[model samples]
Target: MQGFQQSVDIQSLISPLDWVVFAFTIALTAASVLYGNSLKKKTTNEKDNFLDLLLMGRKLTLPLFVSTLVATWYGGIFGVTEIAFNNGIYNFITQGAFWYVAYLIFAFFIIHKIKSYQAVTLPDLIGKMFGPNSAKLSALFNLFNVLPIAYTISLGLFLQTLFGGELLFNMSIGLIFVVLYSMWGGLRSVVFSDIIQFFVMCLGVFLVFSTSISTFGGLDFLKANLPTTHFEPLGGHGLATTLVWGLIALSTLVDPNFYQRCFAAESEKTAKKGIIISTGIWFLFDICTTFGAMYARAVLPEAESSTAYLTYAVQLLPDGLRGLFLAGILATILSTLDSYLFLAGTTITFDLLPIKWREKVSIHHLGVLSTAFISLILAYHFDGNIKLVWKTLGSYSAACLLLPVLFGYLFPGKISDKQFLFSSILGIVFTTYWRNAPLPGFYAQIDELYAGIVATSMGLIICRTLANFRSN
Candidate 1:
């Protein structure tokens, strides 16, 4: 009787119009990928086809660049809302603002250098500057870096919330669509789908924001309902916690999705301008989501905290708009899911395996399958806590690889090969130890992120100082 009652409630939340919009959004995404594939010419050269498939033939304009980049960057949409619902506007300040600074840094300093390299992958560029061994090592960590599970879990939870089902049942079905679109068109397909997704996402969020403000009162209502810490920039968290988030933001410098888009841009100027423009759009979207989540909490305080945004959205929005909003959530996840799956494949075929770029085409497809399986396993492992799923993966990558990748680009040969190797290895080792089994004392107080940063930095300093002394 209880189970039947739950199903009845779920059915009430979605109407016939909502189903039409949801199905249409998905069908349109599939059509877009098929349309992209049809653009390939019979006589296209292998070299040209390779470039076309992976990097969109290095011809992304400013608008395409902005849409794909922004859409892909925020895959953990439900997670963002979860934070906002619980913590208030601080979600925007930490998750959105910290990342904005990192994006600007990448734009001003890194994008030009990356585009100038003409490298297909971050490991390829690292191999050129550091060494093949360094590239291979970075690839191992990059595999951990781009796991698609966080977004997969987000998609799964969204489905389970909207339709009501076991978590794994929804996730398994979600993975099929993700792998299908990703495998069909590669990056071109991903970008094309992103163009559709970007608009849907923006429209859905805006409708909810507008409706919420109109129906539920505005800032005054939020101010009265939310706790003071909700508006606090730091959210009562200390410097250490905030700084850890900043460090995670710094991981953007090493993010392959950013590298792929920058590499795909028609020119350095386009990449630069695109990132700047995208940042503004992200800021606006952040306002909508952050406020929307706050409204959800205010209106539905007793709702399941994980699905608060969707719950309030459905309750507040009209029939068609409810479906559109859910589609936006799926769009947000699918865009990132496909990008990460592809990049993870690149790590396997292009980075880990020593095959010529032109000859290793099939390997990429195989790698995609491998990534999907691994991501599914990880999704199950971390499904218990959605927030920790992303944090754990982000911490591991940021702690171990962020510094070496940054120095490789910025400082180049200033750090010797031996130093670079030790730094990266020690960073991984210290991070694992800090996370799992640090000595109980002052050491226990140090987070894995800080420990990894200190260990890696020490390796570089020691090597450089010894070299200087010996030269003198």
Candidate 2:
């Protein structure tokens, strides 16, 4: 309800020890990138090089798989805290519960199928199933989905909060840091760095929640101080609004990050087990973050929801612990940022480009740099509305890709490639129209995600009927 208000002396909140810890964590992450580069095998074959760079030679161990998957999935940490601060456990239900369901769906139903495909990326898989045109269309949508704009904006906001600089300048610096490390070792670097970040992020949120309980008493304090709406199932939102979040969660079914991890896993069993294990970890982390922010809400009711968790944690944590917490937040953002940047790069080089051009040289590094530059521009353009960036882009991916990708995988030859392409285009058209154009009467209440999905489903059904009629 209140606008973000800054402390007059923001730098004073952080002690010298805290800065040391933050710097050490960042240096350690960069060191992991070098370590990943050391693990790269010397190969002149272009195909092997591509596999090594993007899929880590299809040898992702279970622990590394779990760690990377969990870390990459949770880049929008502040957005989660903001929602939890404002809406209490409802944040867990919408953001956490819905996504957990989606993860299980991927683990149980989709992992085996993905492992069977020889595709290098999600678009490659789409191309194998549908056609080149379909893959290119999906790549365009995948590029939008994996752009890292939201995470860049988050890092910018974090840096601005700490040092008080121009937001765009801070964003550029953060992007440069990620891009530099990411270019050297590719997904291996991203995964190794994620292993460190996964632990840091978990520890950071846990410390905040545990300390809050020690300082402010527990559920009793929250109950007595917070608004009743915070405890409600919908957190005072309409049913449609809550359901729209659930629909967006369906995007996980088609998420490129999930596909990449699954494709990289050494075996189908490892991928399945990794997802199952990561889901448990995610459950614990969500508890820590949601309750931690709820505690912030109770104590700092007027503080900006987006920054309340950080402000309250810094106020409560001791000097050394404060630094670790800050590092954890940065780790959370950077882990996802680098991963998405890599995904965008891979999409461009492997999925979007012609084979001859991509195979002639190592242009993956250039693609990553291009992605970072584009993300910096987009992050600045979006300003700081992380939620809007997520919802808008996420809607397009889910509405257009979910049904087609899932159904295509399940009932392989049933849907034609032309049908897949047409359905996706129809979904895009409806989503764009619903988001930008006013609808007449009751249709106005429908969410853009729903509009896109409905249109896509209709297109699929009509196409299938025509095919069947011709056969008859």
Candidate 3:
């Protein structure tokens, strides 16, 4: 119970009305996820067991699956964090849309190839092409990337700031809201919540933002307040740097979430449609959130963290509106947490744990325990994780995935076991080290992308070449 009293600084100015809005949103999200689950159960005779819990009974519908997949990447902080630091206009480029565009490119070719293999997870596909050794190693790298997860700290900071020490009840409940919902409902719960959340966040964020901009001397006020250079190309970087910025942005495509969505979908058509549509919606959502950060920059003081949109919301919004805004934030956080717990649990169960456990142990118990355990460990280890957990997710993700999925598609039989192993290793090494080139520009990202792309490409080419030579 004492651990329930964990104190972290949050910047909220929320009141009683805010609590009502949040409660309503949670109830609504819960209902939606359960409804979706019920439909799936009715269609299939699959009893609700751990395997079903682990994989949503493999009956995930098109709409809910798409919403859940999109929410996996469109985190509350992901939308709101960069707005202030980059001055809104500059950060417009770093978005989930580009990620979707990346998906669009892959959907026509790569996804079908991956699906053809009937691989349960990405590693399963790799093992078929490369070897068991590579799959095992790939899992290790994935664990490295996925482990030390964040959103806990970001959420913690926001929730603490939102309540601002007013009510003992609010802080405790808000802090555990993500951990609780995620643990209780698993992936099914997370997706349902996300459908409600994404829309609410869109509405609440737009209102808080548009209202704040109107209040604080309008558009002219922002222009006058922000540094003139804020509008400059690259913010502070130079010409070659901006070009590099454009290309490096392309690297967002080669992420784990990219292929994971394909696997998560009910069918290939739904998978393709959901991702493309989500891209557009995500773009609109990002714009509103970034504008809020820009408005905050014009009016609010510098806080302990740059990623403090919730902080601005608490201190800025009217009491009634603040409730709506906080509720939106909770919706986003819950969707993200529940989805992550499900993913994490699967990484262990489907991805790591013994398949034979079904013969000996209860799969339901295993699914629940593993999900809760990983969620708790990751929650506590939130502090020790590598760079912004998102970036770490991106980093660990980019290397392991980029090569195999693409090769598995275009040059299917060409990829050799040796090539897949070495290329992925190189990709990981380059991503981990090249991140700190000290240029304070896109060059750093460019270098990392080059490292991943070149390594992956070379591996594929070399493998195919060798295979051909041997045949000749």
Candidate order by lDDT, decreasing, is 2, 1, 3
Candidate lDDT scores, in order, read: 0.83, 0.88, 0.58
lDDT of 1 by residue, 111-224 (tens): 867766789888788877778777888788888889888887988887787668898888888888788768766788999899889989988888889998998789899888
By lDDT, the best candidate is 2
Measured by TM-score, the strongest candidate is 2
For TM-score, candidate 1 versus 2, the one ahead is 2
- Local accuracy of candidate 2 as per-residue lDDT tens digits, 98-124: 999999998998887777677779998
TM-score of 2: 0.97
Off by over 4 Å in 2: 1-8
Write candidate 3's Cα lDDT for 1-472 as tens digits: 1111122344334467877777777688778867856654433333345434544545557777667765666454633455444545656554433455565676665666666665555566677866876776666655544432454444554554554443333323544555555555455566677788877777777887777766676768778877765565455655543443344344444444455556656777777677667677777777777667776665553543344466566666777777778777766665565555455545565556665653222443355445545544555554523134554455455554655656655666666667777767766676656665565565554646455556666666777788789999
Query: Which pairs of residues collide in model 2?
Result: none
Error in Å for residue 278 of model 1: 0.6
RMSD (Cα, Å) for all candidates, in order, is: 2.9, 2.2, 6.0
**Candidates ranked by TM-score, best first?**
2, 1, 3
